[model samples]
Target: MASYSGNIDYLAPNGVKMLKGIDNDNPERVYICTPLDVNEIKLERHPQDPNRMVAKMRVNICPLSENYKNVVRRSAQERGNANVSVPTHEMQMSFSVGYIKSVAQKFPKLVEQVKEANKERDPEIMGQDPTDENTHLFKAIRQRMNKRLAMLYQPQPPQQPSPYATPNVGVAGAATGYVAPAEGTDPLAGFTDADVGDLPF
Candidate 1:
């Protein structure tokens, strides 16, 4: 007397149907199972569409008894083929933006520690004195702050009169026709290059 534990079902063109509770009166269409020695499982892709695909899976079914050996061998020969093995590796670390942000939030002391360490290493920033060894650092900080304030409260430059302000256009023409005395003439206007003669050469 043989014992079987696993269940089986029929996969048809219409749909899947259970075979366990069905009548076993027909010997020709009855489902049976013998102990099988499974070596490995194989998977393959469908022929039509590589992307929209199907798998061709196989499992080696070794026989426990001589009678079942032929059955298993026949099934194995019908289903089994050369299968490609897949390689997998263990995940070592998972670095994420959220994790980084969380770390920053959770360990602010660490951030402060790093900042303090950097300050210690740098020659130009000790406590808070402009004339100290860290004069350059203090100067840089002051300059940066000044730049920010200047950007915030910057004065607008004076706007120039538009070219179309006076519509009457003429070649070498002025808004007031008469040329006014050249305002504030240079005192050294009459001096020539030879006026300061006395070459050291």
Candidate 2:
């Protein structure tokens, strides 16, 4: 399958029947790939197409043990083919445009989390603000604490545009992107004085 894609059932050739490999009847033909972490999942262009809008993916599989990798290298060296890469079975899968859109609309929470996790990192946050401490251990702790505080107060990705921006929508047009904090805003908006583990409050 040079091109990983699906064909309609009606488009199938005559006298051809698909088998349900999931059945116990054919263990040899069925292959199982481990469930990969959603965060690690990525999509890349299939080598066959450089300018297509298709959704072919080249998943990055987990690395095997160094011993196993060395075995591959040793075998290659014995065969005078050190540059060749190991081969793995790849499954080509495709879904309709409707199916793709449905998956996105179905997993709004997942989509939101993925977007937030991958948002651009702050360009200004290089490290903890340097201190005049002469001790290396103290300097390291201070830098870690500075980074933690910066991450805690970092602004979130922008939310969708809201119709409530108009003056009549709410209390005088509250702009979605840049609304002044309402009167009587919580003085401690980002802090919780509650006990949290061994945190030095």
Please give each candidate's TM-score: 0.15, 0.21
Per-residue lDDT tens digits of candidate 2, residues 1-201?
A: 231222122112112222233435543342322211111122345578875433232322232465766786789999999674542222222222333333334333333333343334532222222222443322333222221111011133455865623221112122123223455543223423242221221
lDDT value for model 1: 0.30
Tell me the deviation in Å of residue 134 in model 2.
54
Error of 1 at 185 (Å): 80
Q: For residues 122-166, could you state the per-residue lDDT of candidate 1 as single tens digits?
A: 644544443232354433332221111010111334458556332
Give the lDDT of residue 110 in candidate 1: 35
After superposing candidate 1 on the true structure, give the runs of residues whose Cα lies further than 4 Å from its correct spot: 1-94, 121-201
Supply candidate 2's per-residue lDDT for 35: 18
Using lDDT as the measure, the top candidate is 2
Worst 10 residues of 2 by lDDT: 145-154
Clashing pairs in 2: 167-173
Q: What C-alpha root-mean-square deviation, in Å, does candidate 2 show against the real structure?
A: 24.1
